[model samples]
Target: MAVSYSFVAFFNSISSSYSSSFSKPSLGSLKPHYGLRVDSKNSSRRLVLSCSSSHMDSNSDTMDIGQTQVSSTAPFGLTMSEANMSRSSCKWQRVLLKVSGEALAGDRAQNIDPKVTMSIAREVAAVTRLGIEVAIVVGGGNIFRGSSWAGSSGLDRSSADYIGMLATVMNAIFLQATMESIGIPTRVQTAFRMSEVAEPYIRRRAVRHLEKGRVVIFAAGTGNPFFTTDTAAALRCAEINAEVVLKATNVDGVFDDDPRTNPNARLLDTLTYQEVTSKDLSVMDMTAITLCQENNIPVVVFNLSNPGNISRAIKGERVGTLIGGTRNSMAART
Candidate 1:
């Protein structure tokens, strides 16, 4: 069925009035927030569910958690649940997805690609349907790169980064809207207080959201300057106790050389944390890589060109580069 005319409006209610507006929703909370049905005009069965959000006003047409209907047209070869069940060998049940702003940019030189965002939302919905908890840390390079302005605009590096963090908030909300459009339960939590737009980062509360099968998008970086979203992703992953981190980028996987510039660069199936650190592979910032290594959390680097790749990566497909852990610092090379 085609998605509805959009259901929720999060800005302000979620982030602005968090202190007074936010309340923890029980996993089986039955507080009914009126929901909509999206399916064939004549479909007999319709789903109704309860959705919880901070400062949900007296509006009937708002975000709600309902049994999602699988589109007859699957994103890949199978439906969301089928794709998930197909991955009985999946190593991690809960994972943190790190998405670069550029990944959502598609062929354009700038701005968020609606197509890419919706595709990602669909794939995420698929994973959640499988009952695998999912959280995300999205970057802001597409809207504005903090460093780009810091160096060129003569702005303080600290303030420039704050701007970049705000950019991420924009990205986060956009993603939230897209996901909700498709009936996926979702929330946006931020490192800093953007009370009008996102909930301030609360570790336990964030975990609760995921436990309820809601996709939590962590935004605003670490709420500190001089830190990339990668660091934020690592930090959130550890706090949430995720099994692994899925680093989605433009490239299909980790390559020996810059695939865009060097044709000889070979796709690496796997590598150790020590190998990435020792060789200084450009997969992630050294700090982010070290954090994951110290926590023993494996990283899966994959391309987000299509919706299926995200689940395929989580399903243990050898789609992208799998960075190794401490137990084995020496594994597949290229």
Candidate 2:
């Protein structure tokens, strides 16, 4: 099905609001507070909203959870089972979701795909509702890659890397916008400062954002030229003290060889950090793999195209290849 015009128009109408929110240095700069306003005329599906701030306000009090104001529009409604499911899924308090640039493209030939973006936003919202604090690090290979263009262009390597960094910022903004449309609060922070667009990356502030249930998007690739975004993912994951790094990719899991090319190649359900690095596995860039290894952060490489896989990984359900960590003692039985 073709992407809906309503989705596009809704995003367009609020583009200025998002821009203003991120571009300014004060929360008060955002005139007319923005909130998720769902159009119920479409269907019964639940909607998620994204919210952002023009500035960081450390003094603001957290939203009260138990306070319920009477709404004249509708009567209260909730099922005990539904509430149980919500509570059970809230175990994961913090996570870092790493999405490659291609995942954002959806079915489009290039650039950001609105449908895919919205779908991801909704999935993130589902886990957030469960009380999981989420932070995202997105790649920019979909729009452009430094290595891909280096052969033809006269641009220096560092310049190309910087361009790639900027591309990530663009992707972050698109994601922030999409999430807000659904009523999910979000914050975009960059290693490189662009006051007109986002806040400068600060570890304390990022953690505070997560503490407030706000999804934080880290961009600009560590503010360095030689590093890949994968390394940035590792760095941010460590900085935020995330329990696991979910590397969402096209493949379901890591294999001894290219599964598509070698029929005998087997999918590795689990692996140790040393095995992955010593064997030169392609699960992630060597630099990123090394960083995760040193930090003892397990990496879960799974197919993002699979619906609900992100949430599954978060719940520690063993859906993908787990690398660079101590294996469970039950391995001897298996």
Candidate 3:
């Protein structure tokens, strides 16, 4: 009878052990020590283990349990660090970047400077790295300024402007080649048809290029005899549905007066489209400002000489003078 009792007791102990092993909560399903219940359906055991391991490793040096809880607030797929990193990385998906012909003249008397071209290319590449779609409208003043030359030589204004437009094409070729050299895909589109040299400007094609993250350089101005490249920039901005128009210039931002000539000149951080037109600010041509105002496109005037400003502007930073409708005020209030 005593031996039988001993056997029964042993069997009972074995059953209890098996039951405990099976019933014990899985670490993944384990509720927080507090009242919080773990969402087991949404997360797997492997993910919980990985997260726990990472948390432990991250706090190995410092035994801060609160940090781990803070890290857990993020969803299952991304850690707190990854979420913050993504927020910082977010940039404008579409932007129209206007680069003047004079900007292409990097320390040169006339025409395209290779160094300047490469510098601008590097800046553009940096923005593209952040996944921003960039469309460029280049001016032809570096190679030829129609107004100045026409005034001196008595050339017809329309003909001189056409010559200026052609100059932009040359700049576009140089820019395209430079950008391609740095492994960035580029497309050169001209308003004036030159099928052998470049694709004719097509609204759909330009939008497609931007969607694919390719740099679209619009050249030959509006293809009209009288329109300036500034006007072209505005037109492209609307067509491409860009969030903002980034006008890169020699000056960093718009000043109340010529900063170089007047030491007391104040840099305007923001201006309304109406104010720019009313004051007749010489930052962009009057026609360009009018188009931007009518279309409700924001214009950011920044210095191209400083590296990384273009990327900064596209990221929605206040690095330059912002000109547009009062719509931004409502956005800020929210």
Candidate 4:
């Protein structure tokens, strides 16, 4: 019995979730903001190269490693207020959700706080039930950061990055378990091949999964070293042609300064892609932001702490900072 129990625990730790793009808006209606900085042509070319190599290569969760497939229709039971009755009527049909690993860590010393994971799972669950196709790209900072790990250890950067990629796979497995437990049908696809744990990420296959209303989780980072998960999120967003990339962070929204340290920091409700790149906001890496700019895909940076904020953003209720092209461009689309 003890051996059997140990085997179950081992399976639960790693083999949990096995699961699971961008449209361009017109540029003519772009509303120029006060300050605009163009992304360097060099950076643009670099991004294109990074994405191109990925066509040559590729691109989470849980303890729920049970053999039984969870039912997708299980009641997530997210209450929508009458004020937000059209919550299901999202502005975009599909989106890529970028969740940081630190957010999943919560207050724990070890990686992954179960409560936070569950909360996020429920948020995704609610969105899936609302009929918006949800695809997720999760980071592994809570468990391991390749750069940091390399800095701390004497290991080479490339080796550390490979280990970090594995950490992302672990996170994907854990999330899969948590989401499945909530009755959401989740699929985990990896940039690197992990035949036993997840499906190899095929762009068309990922899109089909989204169309079928399955929440697809993207793990591993570009199947190559020296690439951050933010880049992975941006790449996946473009590949799948998602309407937007919703980056869920701990703080409420983008601010002039670090909200944690500066009492005077003010939340920004909206920002242009050019402004973000020019100002070098901590929202995401330059590569990720540049890709969004190139594709004209809006990114909503919001607080995952607030329950139901995902639904709010999707419903266009304005809960976080909306980053995209000129206001005129956005307005024309609406």
Candidate 5:
């Protein structure tokens, strides 16, 4: 599946409208007054109706949930030159973005912050425009952590993990909403069955979605207890055949010691699986690192707080720690 004609039209409308239409609005509050018009004959194909201006007719229909309505002319905040970059500039054709639950919380440790999610959506939009297939695995730590809450709340580990899985679903829905509100087409797939809200996780269907240029968000943490989202991310990456795992975090990269505790901690630009495990460095849980190492999947740990870092990482720029990348590949990036 290639980029649909409707999506191309939507992108063109965005490029033109931003240059001539109304002033800029905050990303979080942006509501373009166009509705998603799906051709019944081709249900798989999605079309985004663009709004010419900020003002819209009162009777005009707006976006509906479960449907994609792209309202912004310049939703990604990228210049024409940047958006027009060739697909060859993107190093990896398909990649998995592992977003922690806390990343969506902004400066706090609870709740979903719209501004943070909006920023993430923008970065994803930019890459999708360049023909990259993105699959995301988001964590539930911001809303719930089974391991921590289990002991404190006196709930069994399995029950607590189920609650945490639900938290990931909530985050996934919020992220999908934010992305689709812009010009990006997104789908939410849960590990367990939840047909009413999202598609059940199917490997072939997920690959089809990515091939069709839709960003797929995998929620529910592998549909099992006792496994972390980090492990879920690694598993999904291997299942989807993602070239790399882009682990977006608050920290700049992996450090020799805990950066928070050691002010003099040094950032490690590159490391092998052996070094990460032998050093007991917390780049990811041992399970995740082992999965990636065995499957030959590289993981890039980077600071999500920095604007454009997502784009930079996808472009193979040296923005953060690269674990499991070969010397030749690391040199090329530098």
Candidate 6:
């Protein structure tokens, strides 16, 4: 059997120091807050109506109820509106969006086009407002391609790759600025340490930021040479346990052939990881594909030029090609 105790009684029994911090509210004023389990016996429990003071009185020895600062009402400190939105509309709780640097150029000669960046920012912001957690991995091909630039610049391949990583940092900071302009909170985390500018990549910290409704941007392409941002995105996705990887590109989706070169190339709506590797498809680099395949993470390849595609992908709509682990499964069914 279990014994029932009033909130005031329980506090007094435990320690007199907490008595002032928690007040026993009237039965009519009780809110549906969380409960405290004091009884150890296996038996039914009852609610205790206790409310915290609006402001905690200064106490050196007494501590706050939750040291982690997580909300009692909502998980991850999400606002009530965001929590409701997530519960009602979100198909994927967490998502990783991969944007190629060239897509941000958007037919402009400039390496980073403001108009294109804003367009992408707006879409991402809208999706975020829907209470979905979004992490972005942006490429740097618009500013530099290490493999190609190394041959012409007479620099070592490793040096060129480092420069390319810096370019990704630039793009990440640029996108962060754009997202912030519209009242979205963001954090730029680099793989390698650059504490003067951005936070170094920490798995738990990044996950906490995502839970708090702040978008996290991963830069520096895994902090290594010879690894594309695609691989970085896959690695980040796996580390963060994101549900799917949204690969935003200029084309609608993966095609049987190079769409730009082959006029009659057909867009493949769905593909398995094995089929992609077997056919030598260009969905992503083989390393990235293998990483995602090993982890059973699905990759959604879609057009960034089209508005609402990002949101559609989050909703699991039929907007683009889905590369999943299953064989012969269509996007609509998957």
Q: Which candidate achieves the best TM-score against the true structure?
A: 6
Error of 4 at 268 (Å): 0.8
| Position 322, candidate 1: lDDT | 83
**lDDT of candidates 1 onward, in order:** 0.80, 0.79, 0.78, 0.77, 0.85, 0.83
Q: Which residue pairs of candidate 1 clash? A: 12-196, 15-195, 15-196, 15-198, 16-195, 16-196
State TM-scores per candidate: 0.72, 0.72, 0.71, 0.71, 0.74, 0.75
Q: Give the alpha carbon lDDT tens digit for every residue of 213-251 in model 3.
A: 699999999998778899999998998898788999888
List candidate 3 stretches off by more than 4 Å.
1-91, 151-154, 325-334
lDDT by residue (tens digit), candidate 6, 182-223 = 878999999999999999999999999999889999999999
Residue 43 of model 2 has an lDDT of 21
lDDT (Cα, tens digit) per residue for candidate 1, span 1-334 = 7644443345434334432322433444334443333323433554333244444555534322345544653333466567556445465788999999999788875599999999999889777766678999999999899988996657889989999999999999999999999988889999889788889999999999987778999999999999999999999999999988999999888888888899988998889998898888999999999998899889989889955888877766666888873222332222
Q: How close is candidate 3 to the true structure, as a TM-score?
A: 0.71
| Model 4 Cα lDDT, one tens digit per residue, 32-147 | 22221222343232222112111222331112222445443423453434213434356767889998888888876669988888998888876777677899999999988989
Which candidate's lDDT is highest? 5
Superposed Cα RMSD, model 3: 13.6
lDDT of 2 by residue, 29-143 (tens): 6443446533234324533243435544665333323354443321113344554466465435678889999888766576988877887898898787766789999999889
By TM-score, the better pick of 5 and 6 is 6
Residue 275, model 2, lDDT = 87
Question: How far is 290's C-alpha from truth in model 4 (Å)?
Answer: 0.7
